[model samples]
Structures are given as C-alpha cells and as structure tokens.
Target: MIPMRMPWRQGDVLDLASIGSRVDSLTDLSTIDGGPGARLTAVRTQAQAFRREFIETGTPDSVTTCDLVTLPYPTRFGLFRASRAIAPFLAITNRLLVIRWHESDGTPRVLLFEPSDVELGRYTPYFDKLAGRTPDVVSKRMVTEHATVLTHLARLRIDPSEVDYLMFDHLHTQDLRRWIGTTAPQPDLGEQPTPVFPRAKVIVQRDELAAMADLHPLQRPWYQPGTYRDVPPEAFLPIDGSVVLGPGVAVVKTPGHVFGNQSLVLNTATGVWVSSENVIAAECLTPEHSRMPGLARWAREWGQEVVLNANTIETTVDQYNSIVLEKTLADRSQRDSRFLQFFPSSELTASWTNPGTSPTFTHGAIAHH
Candidate 1:
C-alpha cells in the first residue's frame, strides 16, 4: 500500500461524476449506442479479462459470507409483483462478505461488504412502518441462524486492523458510527465510539455517500443521516461509476435501487457471481421458474428477464438495466444452469420467523474452491 496519511480524503481523490453527469437518462444511452446491451458487453469483456489474469496467476483465495442477521421484510418489496406471494412479511437475511485478494502489484487487501449492525437496523422507519406490526418475540425467532460481522471475522482469524476496505451495496440501512468511529461523544457510551476497523477506509460511490448527508424525503426513512456526521473525511474512498477494486473483483455501478447503488462482482472457481440486493433471490433473475403465484406469470406477461425488489422505484428502468448487466456478467449457475449465478447479498429463507414465505431457491454463500 502506498504510504498515505490516515483518514485521507479518498472520496475526493476519484473523479466519479462522469457516470451521472453526461447522461440525460442511463436508459437513453441504449438507443444511440446499441443500448445497455452493448455497454454491458464491453464491461463483461473487461471483467473477464481481469478474471482470466487472476486465474492464470492466482485469483482470490479467501472469500466467504458472514451471516449477520435476519429481519421481517414485506413480501411486496422482495418480490415487486414478481411473486404473487400473499404474505405480509417475509424473512430477509442480510450478511457481510469478507474478501481477501491481491492487487496485480501483489498487495493484499480485505474488504467487508454490508457488515450491518442489524439490531440498529430495526429502527428504520421504512421497515418499522412495514414490518413493525410483528411482535419482537416473533421477529426474533424469524431467523434460525445468527452471526455478527466482527465475530465472524475473528473466527476466520482476521484482525480488525488488517481489514482494508469497508463497502456496502448501498447505504440504505447502515449506521457506520460504531464501525468507523464518531467524531462526537454520545449518550450511554459516554465517550466517542472507537472504530471496529481503525485503519480501514470505506469504498462507497461518490454520489451515494453524498446522498446520505441530505437524504431525499423518500430516502429519509431509510438512511441514518445522523450516524455519518461525525465520520472523518479520510475514512472514505468514494468513487464514481464502475470500479474494479482488484483482480477478479469489480464493484459495478447498478443504479435505480438508489441512484448510486452498485453490485459486487467476483470471479470464483465455479464462476463469476454478482452480489447485491438488486433482487433478493436466485430465481428473481429467472422469474419464469419462480414458484410464487404472481412472479412467473407477471414476468412472462411483461417479457421481463429480471424482477426487482421494487420497494423503491423512482428509477425502475435503470435498475432493470443494471440487473441485466449483472445477469449478463455472471455465469450460469452450476447447481441450476437455468438461472444466472447472480446472488442476493440478503437472501430470503423459510423460517418460522416469517411463516408464509419461501424462496424457490436460496444461495446463502458464494464459497468456491
């Protein structure tokens, strides 16, 4: 790693606005230049080149999911009419991805993706307003498995200080005050919060990080705007558009879920897998196979290739294109070739916690080789 001052202003270091500035609409770019299909092909070519280089020498040797927590998600949001699931609330499991890889120069790096403090997440008004009716006793039982990001990292024998990058698919329900440390002291703790990964820098999209400061009315209920105020500027590595963090790994810009929403792409021994909440299940990529009553029929009716978790959709078209980019970039699933290998960072699972819902297929982990 280059010797740089701690808390460096990495967010300011990259000129990331080109992705959002020139285009009047990302979808419009489609007609002029063979649309998103052409653009996606270019990206896939580049991503595969990166992967081939990694595999010939060495790809990522360490990559695993750290199951964090589960919550009650409204069925409507998870399926977005892709599934005619009648359940009011479905079980959504969120996890963190711990990735270790080497740059072409041989520097090792570690990134923690979506290492959320789920307990703190319960307060999100968007969720509370939707799943709030469930009793805590019932919600607590919703997830049969539980783990913390910090605890899971330790079990893997990784030290917090050794962690290099902290990332998220989006900042919708994240509170980084404890993870990155706060500049101000707070109640209860009596002192400023110390960071979990003191030397780590968060790699977030430039626009996404900026949006957290002054959230839109639509964004307010979901973002913890207050949690970021005390974070030091040097603690972030904000970039614009798609970025290949290292060999075999790229964080591609996937707008629509949020303007700055991006998905993680990793090339594994089995194949390339894109991970994000762009959709919540493996079948969402191939909705025709969805067992949910409405999902398959709705997808077939519309000639749609992907079904979104459309709880928030001011930019639905862009999300549709973005998810297609993911599906295009990923390899077909080994277990089920009919589906793409794109995995949901937060997968839906059947648990007594939310009795009425179940995913046609679940991919809880992405460990290959």
Candidate 2:
C-alpha cells in the first residue's frame, strides 16, 4: 500500500451538529446595500462564525434518507487522464448529481450539483476534434435520452421548480444564468434569460463568488463571462464554511482545487455520501498497495497527494488537506468495514461497471419515504 498519512484516528467522527445554526447566522447579502467590499466583509464574518461554531459542537443529527440521481453528460476521458493509451480517444460520461433529502421538519428539498447544459455546446472543446461536431451533438442526444437531469427528475415526477437549491463544488465553466435566469437582456434574445428552476436558491461560497467577480487571467477561460453579473442578490444563498441544508445534508468547505471548493455531505441508508469533484473516481481513494493503474497509478508513482482536476489547483497543500479530510470522513461513515462510500459529483464512467468503487449508482433509488 502506498503509505499515506491518515489525518484522523479510525474512530474519530466529523462534528456537524452546529452547522444549521452557523448557516442561519450568515448575513443575508440582499440586505446589504454596499458594493463588493461589503459583500466580502459579510463573507469573512460568516466564515469566522462557522469555524467558531464547529469548534463548539459535535456531529449533527442524521437524516432518514439521502437519495442521489446521476445525470450523465458527454465528455472525453482525457479530461480525467485515466490512462494515456485510451485517454485521448475514449468518450466517457461527465456525471452530475441531484440530491434529495428531508429537513428536520420533514420538508422535501432538492439540490442540483454541477448540473450542465451540454445542449448549449459549453463542453465542445473537451471532445476529440477528429470526431468532429457530430460527437458533441451525439453525446448531447445520448445524455438527454438516457440520463439528463430533467429526464431523471421527470421519471421521479419531481418538478424543476420544486428544487430548493443549486450548487457547484467550484465554479469552472458554469453558466448559472442559464439555469436561474438573468435580470439583463440577453444578446441573443434581447430579453431576460429564463430561469430553469424558478424557485430554487443558488448556494455558492462567498469566496468563490468573489473570485468569479475578479477571476485571474488563467481562470477566466474556464468560466462563462457575465453569467452571474445580472443575477439578483436575493437568488443567492452564500455561505462561508460548513452549513447544514437539513438534518442530514450539509455543504462543507473542502478547498484545494479552488479556494471556494466545497463538498456535499449526506447521511444516507448506505452511508455518508460526499459529492465533490476533488477525486475524479473511487479508484483514487483506494489503498496504494491495491494495484491501481492509469491516473491512480501515476499518482502513486509521482507521490502526488491526490488526483485532482488539472485546471483547478490553487495550492497542493490545501488540496492534500481537503482530500485527507474527505477520505477520513468517508472512512468514519462506512456502513461496512470492507469499503468507503464517498460520491464524486462528476462521476467517472469506469465507476458504473467497476465494483469496490467509492460511490456506485446501479442500486440507487429516489426513496419517497
């Protein structure tokens, strides 16, 4: 096994109990009338509040059920750098997730993580050029027919308007205005961009929003310009650190890939499920001695802390700490000693057929009870 350092003891559990209160303590950005400076102050204050609260409290109460629905988008294997042999040529699923859970009062809530709009051609550059635009069109059709987020929700009979929240682990090539609508006129339509989920609040880390507003040159290309510029402040639910969405659901800052990167933690029938893109596949979390290959093996050979999305690394130390915390949490939440069950928001295509994976969806269900 690759001798990796474990950040926490085998029996230690993550403290989550005060998360709801911490989230509630955050200043409502809509109420502040000042510019970005005021927003930044509020965000910093919120972060401090969360850290203080977490230090005082232990773990939160578990929820009854946490259901996940996978929505696959078209993308290339090279994005994950699995194996050089097939990486450049292979087509794979860029899976996103829709999480449904109940609050303390038993109110139903839906949260969409990394929901993509492939139909808008946002991911075309990631595909094989020789395959031409045909692959892009074909991939969109495949996802829409087999695993579009809306299609899966439709099958579950969940209305988009009923979705309570939307979030992303980090902002990379996301166009929120496409889903939540914009107040300004669209150049193409000369009208406001229509909201896909009219009632949902978009949750974003305060730091992440600040960075997007003034993105570095290197990070600019990965984001869709002006996407959030016209969004009303009321639609945003910004948090600084860990915050409980409900009894069993919470979003915790797991920064490394990006300063604002966070992970979704859920208490499910199976175990604790963390949905983030920090680790692209379950294989990355396996023990070093388990005979890994491709990206996992490369990581082992290079002594890299974790296999991460190439474009998002702000610092290696932060990423390493985040990965260790996630792994430790997953280990602590195991339903069985034989495995760990953390879910990656953008799931690997290999996970569907592979056993011993961190998060498998073959038996996943949208339980109503």
Which candidate wins on TM-score?
1
Show model 2 residue runs off by greater than 4 Å: 1-19, 23-86, 89-92, 121-145, 287-305, 332-339, 350-369
**Model 1 worst lDDT run, 10 consecutive residues:** 18-27
Residue pairs of candidate 1 with colliding backbone atoms:
7-234, 30-35, 82-295, 84-294, 142-353
lDDT of 1: 0.73
lDDT of 1 by residue, 1-369 (tens): 222222234346654342112111223223436665576555455445544543343357678887888766778888887665556778788888988987656777888888887766655777666556667676557644488777898898899998988888998888777788877786635779989889888778776766565566776777766556567877777776666666566677788899889888887888788999999988888888877678788988998888898777847877887787677678888887877787788888776544446777777787854
The per-model lDDT (C-alpha) reads: 0.73, 0.55
lDDT of 2 by residue, 9-96 (tens): 2333323342254456544443667764565455556544643444333333332222232323222222234343322322234455
Candidate that would win on lDDT: 1
TM-score for candidate 2, please give it: 0.67
